[model samples]
Target chain A: MKTFKLGGVHPPENKLSQSAAIEVLPLPETVTIPLSQHLGVPANPVVKKGDSVKAGQLIAKGEAFISANIHSSVSGTVQKIDDVVDTSGYRKKAIVIKVEGDIWEDGIDLSKDLVKDISLSPQEIVSRVNEKGIVGMGGATFPSHVKLMVPQGKTADVLIINGVECEPYLTSDHRLMLEKAEEMLVGIQIQMKALNVDRAIIGVENNKPDAIDHLMKLIPEYPGISVEPLKVKYPQGGEKQLIKALVNREVPSGKLPIEVGCVVHNVGTSFAVYEAVQKNKPLVERVVTVTGKGVKEPSNFVARIGTPIANLIEAAGGIPENTGKVINGGPMMGKALSDINAPVTKGTSGILLFPQAETSRKPVHNCIRCGRCASICPMGLEPYLLAVLASHKRFDDCETEKVMDCIECGSCLYICPSGRPLLDQIRVGKNETGKMIRLRNR
Target chain B: MNEITLISVISLGSLGTIAAIILYMVAQKFKVIEDPRIDIVADKLPGANCGGCGLAGCRALAEEIVKKESLEGMSCPPGGNEVMGEIAKVLGLEAKEQDPTIAVVRCSGSRENAPPKVKYEGDMTCAFAHNLFAGEGGCPKGCLSYGDCVASCDFDAMYMDHKTGLPVIKDNCVSCGACVKACPRSIIEIRKRGKKDRRIFVSCINVEKGGVARKNCQVACIGCGKCVKECKFDAITLENNLAYIDFNKCTLCRKCPPVCPTNAIHELNFPPRRQRPETKAEPAEA
Candidate 1:
C-alpha cells in the first residue's frame, strides 16, 4: 500500500457512522439553497420569487468559468432569494424554497438501473456534468467540468478517483464506494472518456477493505480501470497528495494536479457524473454522515442539499444535551458551524457534534520552538512561522513562506502540544496572501 | 623590537589607515542630504507610533511631510491638532484644525448584565474567543471581554473593568483607533469628544432581532424604534436590527437614554443624578 511521501498524522479514526447504512432523510419543509454553494464565483439566480420550480430545475446558473449551476433540491415555489448565514458563520445569498412536491425535471432517469454506455461525445459529457452542477464532492466543491476540460496545451495521462475518505468520522465516501460500486465504475469510465484518458486508478484506503475488495472484484468488468489500496493517512485523499500516492508524481507548489499529468475526482463525484450522463440527474442531494462521539445515534443520511443541520441532528437523535459545537465536515478540516439553522450545501460531507466537555479549546501557550508543526504539515510548510507572520500581519513574509499553499488540514493544530492556533492563523494568512497574489497578478 | 616585527607593524598600520580613509570617503559619498526641519517636526509630533496617520512610523511621516512641503493632508490623531500645530510651526506651514476624538466601547453587555448561558473555556483574547464561537452569551455579535482591545491600546487608555467584565475607556484616551481596529467584533468607535467629554451613544452593538437581543443582554438595542420616535433631533436611526446615533447630529441632551426601554442608549461623563421622586430602580439581570 502506498501513501503520500510527506508529513501526515494518524488521528484516532472515530468512524462512528461506519456501520450506519445510508438513510434517505425526509423532505425538509423548507430548503435554503444557497447561490454560493460551490467554490468559485457564486451562481447567478435566474428564478424570481413566487416562481414554482421542479426538483432538478436549474434555478441558479454558473456565471463565471469556474462556477457551477445550482438546482432546487425539491419541487417548490421560490420564497425569496435573500441572505442567510451559512455554516462558516458568514452570510451569503441563498434561495429559500418552500417544498410542495418531489417532482424531478422531465427526462431525468430516476431509476435504479446501471447505465454503462457513454453515448455523448467528450465535449457533450463535460457540458452535461456542468449542467448537472457536479463538483468535486470531496468537500472542495471545485467545478468538475472545469477540471475535466484540460487546458489547451496540457494533457492528463491518468484519472485518479478519490475513494480514500481519510478524514476520521467521515465514511460517506467509503459507504458510497461500497454501495454504488457498479455506478461508480461506470462513472469513472465516463470521466476517463471525458478526459481522453484510457487508464484510471481508483485509490481506496486499506481501512476500507470491503470497498477495496468489492471494487477489485468488479474491475475486470470495467476495462482500463484498476483499484489501488492505500495505507490509511489523513489527507492522502487530497488531490495533490493522492496523485503523489497513486501515480508517484509530485504536483509542484502553487500548481494544479494537471501539472503532474493527473486529475482527481471524488468517488461521489464520479457517481454524480454517472447519474448526470446516464440518469439525467443534476447535483441536488448527497450522502451526509451525521456522527459524533457524543451523539445518541450516529447515522449516515442521503439528504437533500438545502436541509438544515438541525434536521440531520434530529435524525441522528435530537441535539445531544451536552452538544457544544456542530461542524460541517470532519474534525480536522470542518468549519465550526455558527448557526444550526444554516442549510447544507453541495460540499457538506459530515456533520459532527462535539459535547461541551470535548468543546473546551485547549489553552494556548507560546511556541516551544518544537518544530512539530513544520514536521507534520502535509503541505510541507512551516505552520508555526506562518502563524507568527499572520499574527504580525506580515503577509509578505507569509507569501514568501508559501502560506497560501496550506490546505488547512489542521494537521499542525492537531499535533501541536502547545495548543497554538496554527491552522486558524494559517487560514487567515492564506486569505491575506491569496489577496496579495491576486492583486499582484492584476 | 626586532626589525621584522617593526616592518610588519608598519605594513599593518598603513593598511589600517588606507582602509579607514576609504571607508570615510565611501560614507561621505553615500551620505543622504535631508531637510533638518524633518527631525524637528518629528520631535514635535507624538512618538506613540500608533500608525494612525497611515504612515509606517512618525519618522516616516515626518519625511513625507517635509518631502511634500506641506501639512495639507497629514495629521497625527494621537497628538490631535496641537501636535500638528507644533509640526506646522517647525515647517513654516499652516496647521489644519480638527476635532479631538476618543474611542468608545459600544457594548455594555457586562458579566452581571449579560449572563453567559454557555461558558467558553478558550484563550483569553477576543481574537481567539471570536474564532472559537459566538460570545459566551447568546448574542453572536457582543463583546467577548477578552481584553484584545486593551492589549492593542498603545497608550493605557483602555482597561477591562473586572467587576463588569467589560472594557472601560479611560478619560485620557487618544482615540488612536488602534482599539477600534483591534476589536474583532468592531464594537469600538472613534467619536468626537464632546465638550467636557460628555457624550451620548448607543452602548449595544448586537444586531440580533428584538426578542433575541433582549434575551442575550439587558442593554441590547433591540431596534424597537422607541429611540427613533422619542428623539426630537433626528440623530438616531435603526438599521440591521440595531440603532445607531450619528454623533454630529446628537445634541447630548441625554433624552434618548432614559426613553430607551432596554437601557441600550448610554450617556457618558455626566454628573451624578439628583434624586427625583419619579426615578426608579431598573429591573435586575441574571
Candidate 2:
C-alpha cells in the first residue's frame, strides 16, 4: 500500500453515499449553463437567446488554448443568455435554456452498448475529445484535450488514472469506477493512445475494495493497464500526490505531471473520455453525490450539467429543516454555495449539507507555535508562517516561503489544535503571491 | 605597589586616547552630509508614517522634500496644508493650497438597508470573506462589514457601528486614505469635505440590474439616472447600473437626494430639510 511521501491526514471516511447506486436524475425544467465551468479563460458563447439547441450542441466554444468548450445538456430553446449568480456567489455569464424534451444532437450515439475498439488515430482522438468538451470531471474540471496534447519536448511514458476518491463523503468517482469499470478501461486506453504511452496505472484507495477489485478484474482485458491500490490517505486524489503514490514520481514544484514523464487523469474523466471518443457524447453530464448527516437519503445521481443544485438536493430527500450550510463539494476543500439555485457545473462532484449546530467554525485561538500545520502540510510549506506574513501584507515573504506550493487540502487547518484560520490566510497569501509573480513576469 | 599602579594607569589612559582618535578619524572618513532642512521638514510632519503621501515614511518624505528642493508634489496627508505650509516657509518655497478631503464609505448597505441573506461563518477578515463569497447581504459590491477599514485606520478615526454594521468615520480622520485602500470592495473613497464638512454622494456601489440590485439591498443604486437628470451641475454619472457623484462638481443643491427613488443618495452632516407642503399632502392622500 504505497502513499505519497509527504504529510497526509485520515479524516473521518463519511462514505454515506458509497452504497447508493447512480440514478439518472430527471431533466430539469431549465438549465443555466455557465460559460466558465472549467479552469482558464471562459468559453465564448456561440449560441444566443431564442436559439433552439440540441442536447449535444456546442453552445460555447473554448477559443483560448487553455479553455474548454461547453455543450448544452438538453435539447431546448435558449431562454436568455445573461449573467446569473453561480456557486461563488458572483454573477457570471450563463446560457439559460428551457428544457423541452429528451432530444440530442445528430451523430451522438444514444446507445447502451459499450464500444471498445480504438479505431481513431491518436491525433483524431485528441481533437474529438476537444470537440466533445471533455474535461477532468474530478472537481478541477481542467480541459482534458489540453492535458492530452503533451507539450513539445516532453515525452509522456506513463499514464496514471486517479480512482482514489479520498475526499470524505464524495463517492461519485467511487460509484463511477464500480459501475462503469469496463468503459473506463477503454477510456484509459484512449488516453494512453493519445499520449503515446505504453503503460497505464489506475490507483484506487484500499478503502474502496469493491472498486479496486472491479478494476483489477477488468484491467487484464485491457493490455498495458494495471490497477494499483493505494493506502487510504487524504488528498491522495491530488494529481501530483497520485502520481507520486502510483509511480514514485514527484511532480516538481510549479510544474505539471508531464515534467516527470507522466500524465494523471481522474477516473471520472476517463469515463467521460470513453463516452466522448467511443459513444460520440459530449461532456454534458456527471455523477454528483448528494449526502450529509442531516440528509434523509444520501444518493448518487447521474445528473446533467447546468442542473440547479436545488433539484439534486430535492432528489436526496429534500433539504432538511435543520440544514445550516450547503457546500458545493467535499467538506475540506468545497465552497459553501450561497445560492442553492446555483447550477451544477462540470466541476461539481458532491453536495454536502451540515446541520445548524455543525455549521459554525471553532473559535480562533492564538498560535501556540505548535508547528502542527507545518507537519501536516503535504506540500511541506509552513502554513502558520505564511498566514502570519499574509495577514501583515508581507506578500514578498510569502512568495519566498513557497506559498504557491500549498495544495489547500485543509489538512493543516484540520490538525491545528489552536483552531487558527491557516488555510484561509494561506489562500489569501497564495492569491496575492500569484498576483505579484504574474505582475513581475509581465 | 604605588609605582606599579601609576605605570598601569598611564598605559591604560594612552590606549584609550589612541582608540578615541582613531574612532574620530573613521567617523570623519565615512561621514554623510545631510541637509539640516530635512530635519526641520520631518519635525513639521505628524510622524504618522502612514504612507498616505505614497512615500515610505516621514523621514523618507523629508529627504524627498529636501532633495527635490521644492514642495511641488509633496504634501503630508495627516499633517494637511498647515504642515506643508510650515515646511514650504522653512524651505523658502510657495506651498500649494489644496482642498481638505475625508474618507467616505460609498456603501450604504446597513443592517436595515441590506439584511443578511446568508450566514458567513469562516474567517472574519473582509479580504478572506470577499474571496469566499459575495457577502452576507448578498450584494457582491457592497461593504463586507468585517472592519478591514477600521483595522487599517491608524488615527483612531474609524469604528464599526454595530447597530448599522458599517464603519463610521470620525472627524479626526485626517484623510489619510488608509481605509480607502484597505477596503476589499473599494467601497470607500476620499472626497473633498464640502462646506461645514457636509457632503452628498451616492451610497450604494452595487452594479447589478435594477431589480436584481434591489433584491439584495434596499438602498442599492439602480442606475435609473434620476439623480443624473436632476443634478444641475452634472455631478452625477450613471454607469453599469450604479451612480457616482463627483464631489468637485457638486454644489450642495440638495436636489438629487429627493429625486432618488431608492434613497441611495446620502447627504452627510446637513441640516434637516424644511417639510414641503407637497410631501406632507402626498402622505395625507395616501
Candidate 3:
C-alpha cells in the first residue's frame, strides 16, 4: 500500500458508526441556514422575511468566483434574516425559516432511478455544479466548480478521488462509498470529463478494506478509473497527501494540486455532483456522523445543511450523561461548539461528544529536545520551533521556516509525549505570518 | 643572559608603541561625533524599553529627541511627565504637561454577567481562542478572559481576577498600552486617569444586535441612545449597536450611568450613591 513519503501518524480508528446505515433525519422545526458555508466570500441573501421558499430553492447567490450558492434545505416560510450563532460560536448572517411542508422546487427530479448517462458538455457541467453549490464535503467546504475550472497553463492529466476518511470516528464518507458506490463512480466519471482528464484514481486507506473492495468492483464498469489502497495514515484524506499517495506526485509548498497536473475531489463531493448533474438536485443535504464512546447510538444521518446539531444529538439518543464537550467535526481538527443550538454548515463531517475525563488537556511540559513533533509533522516543518516562535511573536522567523505550509493535521500534537500545544501555537503563527505576507504584498 | 633580556624588552616596547600610534590614527580617521546629551536623555528615561513610545527602545527615543531638538511628537509612556521634565531640564528645554492615563478593560462580561456557554480546551492564550471561536460567553467582541493582556504586562500592573474572569489593572499601570496591544479583541483601552483617579465609561464592547447582545451578556451596551441623550458634555456616541464614550469630552457628570437600562456604564473610583427617598417610599406605598 502506498502512502505519503514525508510524515504521518496512526491514530485509533474509532469507527463506531461504520455499521449504522445513513438515516434520513426528519426536518427540523426551524433551520438557520448561514450564508457563509463555504470558503471565500459569503453569498448574498436573496430572500427576506415573510417570503415563502421551497426545498432546493436558491436562498443566497454566490457573487464571487470562488464562492458557493446556498439553497434552502426544507420548504418553509422565512421567519427572519438575521445573525445567528454558527458552528464557530460566532454570530453570522443566516436565514431562519419555519418549517411548513415538504415542497421541493420545480425542475428537480425526485426519484430513485439511476441515470448512468452523461448529457451536459464539460463547460455546462461546471456551471451546473456551481449552480447546485456542490462543495467538497470532506470537512473543507471548498467550491467544487472552482476546482473543475482548471487555471490557465495548468493541465490536469489525472483526477484523484479521496475516499480515505482518515479522521477517527468519522464514517460518513466510508458509509457513502459502501452504499452509493455506483452513484459516486458516475460522479467520478462526470468530474473526469469536466476536468478533461483521461485517468482517475480512488484512494482509500487499507483499514477500510470493504470500501476499497466495493470501489474496485465498480471501477471496471466505469472506464478510466481504479482504486488504490493506501497505508492507514491520519491525514491521508488531505488533498496533497492523497495525491502523493496515489499518483506519486507531491504538490509543491504553497501551491495547489493542479500544479502537479492533478485535481482532487472527495467521495461525498462526487456523489453530490452525480445527484446535481443526473437528478437535477441542488446540494442541500449531507451525511453527518454522530459518534463517541459516550453516545448511546453512534449513527450516521443524512442531515440538511441548516439542521441544528442539538437535533442530531437528540436523534442519536440524547446527550450522554457524562458528555463533556461536543466538537463540530472530527477529533483531530474539529472545533468545540460553544452553543449546541448552532446550525450545521456544509463543512461539518462529524459531531464527536467526548466525556469529561477526555475533554481536559494534559499538563504541558518543557521541550526536552524530543523532536517527535517535527518527526510526525505531515508537512515536514519544525512544529516545536514554530510553536516557540509563535508564542514569542517572532512571525518573521516563522514565515522563513515555511509556517504557511502546515496542513494543521494535528499529528504533531498527537504524537508529542510532553502534551505541548504545538498545533495551537502553529495556527496562531500561521495566521499572523499569513497576515504579514498579505500586507507586504499589498 | 642580561644582554639578551635587554634586547627583548626594547624590541617589544618599540612594537607596542608603533601599534598604539596606528590605533590612535585609525580612531581619529573614522571618528563619530555623537551628541553628549543623548546619553544624558537616555539615562533620564525609565529604561524599560517597552516600545510604548513607538520607537525601538529608550536609546532610540533619546536619539530621536536629541536629533529633533524638540519633544513635540515624542513621549515615553512608561516614563511619565517627571522623567520628561528631568530630560528637559538636562537639555535646557521646557517640558510639556500631558494628561496621565491608565489601562482600563472595556468589557464587563464577567463570570456572573456572561457565563461560559461552552468549555474551552487547548491553548489558553486569548489569541488562539479568538481564532478558534467567538468566546466562552458567545460574544465575539467581548473579553476572552484568557489573560493575554496580563501576560504582556511588564510592570506587574495587571492580573486576572478569578472571581470576575477579567484582567484587573492596578494603579501602577503607566498607560504603556502593552495590554491594549496584547488584547486580541481590543477590549482594553488607554483612557485618561481623571481627577482623583475617577473615570466613567461604558464597560461593554458587544456590537451585536440589541436582542442578540443581551442574550449573551446582561450588561452589553445596546446603543439605546439613553446615555447619548443624557450626556450634557456630548461625550457619548451610539453606533453599530454599541455605545462609546469619548474620554476627552467626558466631564464626569455621573448622569448617564443612572439612565442606562442595562447598567453597562461603569463608574470607577467614585463615591457611593446617596439613598433616594423615592426608592424608600415605594416600598411603603406597595
Candidate 4:
C-alpha cells in the first residue's frame, strides 16, 4: 500500500484495452525501422539499400555502450535508408525494408519449453544480453546491459522489477505479466543473480489486481522475491518514481536507483533478458497496444520491433473512419505520429489512435494559476512559473526553479484547466538552461 | 568659590572639545571615496527596475557603466533609446542606433479561418497547447493562438486577434521580442517597420503538406509553387511545405500577394487599393 510521498493525480482509469488478449500482427509489405529508437546515440546502419536481411539479423549496430542494436523484424530486402518523419514529428534517418519471406535467424530457439535454469556466469549473461541488444522494453529502451553495468562504488542490494502499467491505455506490461509470469520471474532471478542482489521485488499497480494476484501465485516458490502492490499513478513506472513507491526512498536527482542501493528492471525487460540469457533471442519483437476510440478494434498484439503502425492497425481492424491522430505510446507522454508508416521501435508500447474530437487542440488562453499542475507534479516542480520563465527566455530563472529536475511527465498539462502547454515550454527552458550550464562549465 | 568652580568647568569644556575634534578627524579618515558620475548616471535612469538590462537596478546599471569602460550592447529596454543616449553621453561613449521593429505573427489562421482540429480541455497556455499536441487545428505547424505571446507581452501592444486566432502587434509595439519568444512555433518575428507602416511578409507558418494544410485550415498555404513562379525578385523560398518571404530582398512590389492563390502572402501598411473593374469578394470563413 506504499506510494511515493509526493504529488500524483488519478485520472479516469480508462483501461479499455486491459481485457483484450495480445494478438500477433501480420507482417506488412515493408517496415520503416528508425535507428534513433533508443535513448542514447543512434545505432549505425550495417546494411545498405538492396541488401537482403533475415529476421533477427543485425541491421544496425550499437555505436555506444548506452545504445541498442537494431535487428531486422522481417526477412526482407533493404528498400532504402533515408530520413523519415518519426512519431515525435522530427525527421530522423531510418532503414526501410521490403518483406520477402518469413525467414528467421538460424540461431533462434523456436520452442515453447521453459528454460528455467541457466548456468552462465553473470558476466556471460550480461555479455549475451549485450550481444542480443536487449533493452528495458518499458518505453525507455535503455540498454539493459548498460544498466546492469552499475557504476563503480555503488552496490545493488535489491533488484526491483517494475510491472506497473500506470499510464492510461497501456496494457502491454499487464498482459505480459499475466501470460509470461513464469518467464518474467525467471528473468528477475537472472537479474538478481547477475547483480548479486539478495532480494527482488515485483511492483504492480493495484489497478491490475489480477496481475498482482497471478504474479503472487506464480512467485510463491521464490521466498527471496515479493509482489508489492502500488498505487496506480501516471509515471509510476519511471525509475525514480517506482523506486520511491516501492522502497519509500527517493533516488537523488541525476543518480540511478542502483546508486541508492537498489537496481530496477521492467517486467517486459525481464522477459527480454530471459530470452537473451537463455534462448539467445535478441529484442526483435515486443507487445504493442493498438487501442483507442479511433481504432475499430481495440486490442494488444505481439508485434515485431520494426512493424509499421499501419500493419498493427490493420491487424486490429484497420484505422477507424474517425481517426485523426495516431500516437506511438500512451496518451500522457506519447508522441503523435505525423506518418503512420513509421515502424515500431524498442520503446514503442502502444499505438493509440484518437478520433478527431479527441486529437484537436483548443485555443490557449491566459493561465489562471489553478495550481493543479503543482498538485499533480510527481517531481514536485511548479510548471506554471517554469512555462512563464521559459516564454520570457529566463534560462537563469528556470535553473533557479530547478527546471532540470522536471521529468516531463505531462501531468501538469493533463490537469491544467486552462489548457496550458507547461511541458513544451519547460522543455525549451530546460534545454536552454542545460546549454548555459554546459557553456559555463566549458 | 567662584574661581575654583570656573577652573573645573573650563577643564571639562576643554576635554569635551578635544573629544569632538578627534571624532571628526576619524570620521573624515574613514569616509569611502567613489566616483561622482555613478550617482549622476543613476539619477538619469528610467527607475523602472525591470531587470531587462541584465542588471539589478538602475543604480547597479549606472555603477557598472561608470566602472566598466565598455558599454557594448547594453541598453535598458524600459528607458528606450533616449535614456541610453543620455547614459552614453555621460560616459563619453557612443550609443548604438538599433533598428525599430515590431512583432509580426506569420500565421493568419483565426478561428474563423483555421478551424479546430481537436478540442483541448487541458490548461489554457500556448506552451501547454503546443506540448499536448499540434495546434488545435490539424496543421501541426500553424499558430496555436493560445495567447502565450499576448500574455507574455508586458506592453499592451500585442493582443489576440479573436477573428484570426493570432496575436496582432499595434503600431506602439516596442520590439521587445517577448512575444517572439513566447510563441511556441516561433511564428512571431521582429520585422522592420516599413514606410507608412507597410511591409510585406508571408502569413502562413504551416509546414505540413499542401493537402494536409488545406484540410486543417482554409487560409493555409497550399505550397503550389505559384508565389515562387510569380516572384521576379527571388524573395520567396519554400521548404517543408511552407513559404517564407525574405524581407531583405522584397521590394514591397505587392506582386506576390495578388498571385498567391491561397492568399498566404500578406502585404501590410499599403494604401487603400483603387477600385478595380472586377474583384472577388473576401471569402466568408467558418
Error of 4 at B158 (Å): 1.6
- Give the per-residue lDDT of model 4 (tens digit) for A1-442: 7777688777777777898988877777888889988889889999999999999899999878788888888898999998665665545789999999899899898686888886999998888888888888887778889888767888888888999877888899999999888888888888888888869989999999999899889887765889999877777878888889888778887667877888888899999998878777888889999888766668989888767788888888888888877888888878877668778888899989888887766557689988889888899899999999986779999998999999887888778888777877888788778889999999
Q: Give every collision pair in model 2.
A: none
Best by TM-score: 2
Query: Top model by DockQ, which number?
Result: 3
Model 4 global lDDT (CA atoms, 0 to 1): 0.81
lDDT of 3 by residue, B1-286 (tens): 6999989999999999999999999999999999999999999999999998989999999999999888886888888999998998999888899888888999989978888887777788999999999988888999899999999999999999999999999999988888898999999999999999999999988887777788778888877787898889889999998889999999998888887778888999999889522311111100
For each candidate in turn, the TM-score is 0.88, 0.95, 0.94, 0.76
The TM-scores, chain A only, for the candidates as listed are: 0.98, 0.99, 0.99, 0.97
- Between candidates 1 and 3, the one scoring higher on lDDT is 3
What TM-score would candidate 1 get against the native? 0.88
lDDT of 1 by residue, B51-115 (tens): 98888889999999999989887878888898998888877889878778889989888887798
Clashes of 2: 0
How accurate locally is residue B137 in candidate 1, as Cα lDDT from 0 to 100? 70
CA lDDT for candidate 1: 0.88
Worst 10 residues of 4 chain B by lDDT: B277-286
lDDT of 2 by residue, A278-358 (tens): 989999999999999999999999999999999999999999999999999999889899999999999999999999998
Measured against the true two-chain complex, the DockQ scores of the candidates, in the order shown, are 0.22, 0.69, 0.75, 0.12
